[model samples]
Target: MTTVFRKALGALPRLGVQVLDLGPGAAVVSRRGGYTATKMSGDSWMVGGKRPRTRTTADGWGLHKAAAGDLCARHVADLLANYEVNCVFDVGANKGQYGRQLRELGYRGRIVSFEPVPDALARLRKSAERDPEWRVYPFALGRSESFEDMHLGWKTMNSLLQPSAYGQRRYKRFTDTRKEQVRIRRLDEVMDEALEGIAEPRPYLKMDTQGFDMEVFAGAGRRTADFVGMQSEVAVLQLYEGSPRMNEAIAAYEDAGFAITGMYPVTREKTTGRVVEFDCVMARAAAAPSRQG
Candidate 1:
């Protein structure tokens, strides 16, 4: 491999783009090659870099490899051909960075957000206060439709519904917590009440509630729209020992008609032995066999 090829891998790691394979095809799942990624199968993909000879532009400017396009789709054809997504239902929307990014990119549609931690809720609310299109939900969305006393993980910014599952995580970053009761909602129910009146269409959904994506999906019930696209900040199997089951998650999403098309990292290990991690699964609703034609 050339120095540029090596640099592409090393450079994008900083921005959290870890899902790249350098040949032999289908074996990318086991292509750890020292990096961390969710093992995948089936045809739910929009990009490929399996050929060892195709490693040069793995992080180039077009798709089909690893270059950074407008939204990081590894394949140019997918980026340019896929249906355009406008509305966003952002579950577990921490500081509203996702929302901000959408706005920065000139996304002109509704952004319904959900967050559990009070600190994050406040910050997210303030960050989006000026945007009329942003509707922030100061609560967590799960299978339950009631309030619960969720333990604010030590890193309040990285809080989760099940605290003990995190064992003990202590980051030196500035994080604080105030444990008061927080509301939980079944996403479908909340949408029925809060957004039912809107004459416009439904929105695309993004979930990053720790390992709580499946729970949120269940609460969504049959409320899923046909044209909806979904993105999630999913947890990789290797991180957080004893974390939620990955197969169950993939199956749950598949059941909901979402095909996992792409995965991107968002955090890199600052040290040698720690490891780089995080995958945001980009998915789209798949039609039934009968509807595909």
Candidate 2:
């Protein structure tokens, strides 16, 4: 590849363009909008029109980063498309970030988001109001139906489990700032009710409940078989009290008949480069005995 072509390929993610290799010495660039840029030999490029404005939100940046690096969103898109997923259970959906990213990535499935934090839920509701297929629920999913004290942090760090001492020291922004009493329900109890009568619902569950992913899974019960894939935030360090470590989290999911497919780093300790937490994607293992007859 020429230096210019290499640079363009390297910058495509930040530029929000998808490259299609035509052959040696030529490629096509597809952008978010309907415009296309063609790269020819010797630093030569051709564009049909002016470039569209790029997205600047954190979710947009993450999606583009994944697109650039061939990471999380790419795997997610593949799972959704391959499984023909019709429903998405977005657990711990803060401000509908995951749902929004899904739509941007071409997922047209029905989305049911559960968020218990008052402020976050409000924003989530507004974000999904215009989308008829996207529904927002104002409750958390746990091991059972009950009320719990949720520790609220600077932003998305809120969780049912208390922040760990390591978390507080390593990341000051994750310090528990306040507590809120929130209603919690089990996925087994709410899944059918929330997605009643959806035609052939192949659900993809995505959880970002901070340290409470296992509790959420415990509540899923036999309903786990109904899901085609699941994505959860797995902690490397003990970010929250009672939260499972990376190995433990993987083991729990594996025991549930899912196999690890992808791991996307979410945060890292700035100095030591130790992973803080990452998103783990799992699909039902093919070798596992079929739940259906």
TM-score to native of every candidate shown: 0.61, 0.75
The CA-based lDDT of model 1 is what?
A: 0.58
Candidate 1's residue-wise lDDT over 26-129, tens digit each? Answer: 22332333432332233333444343545443232224222222333323123213444445688878888778877765576778888878778889999889
**Model 2 Cα lDDT, one tens digit per residue, 1-293:** 36887777768868778775555567667775354445433344444443348733533444333332245776788778877788999999999988998998789989999999989989999999999999888999999889989888668878788778997887687744788899999999988877787977788889989889999999999999888889999888998899998899899888888888888777755455566788899888563235432
Assess each prediction's global lDDT (C-alpha) against the native. Answer: 0.58, 0.80
> Which ten contiguous residues of candidate 1 have the minimum total lDDT?
60-69
Candidate 2 residue pairs in backbone clash: none
RMSD of 2: 9.0
Which candidate number has the best lDDT?
2
Model 2: residues with Cα > 4 Å off, grouped in runs? 1-70, 174-176, 287-293
Best by TM-score: 2
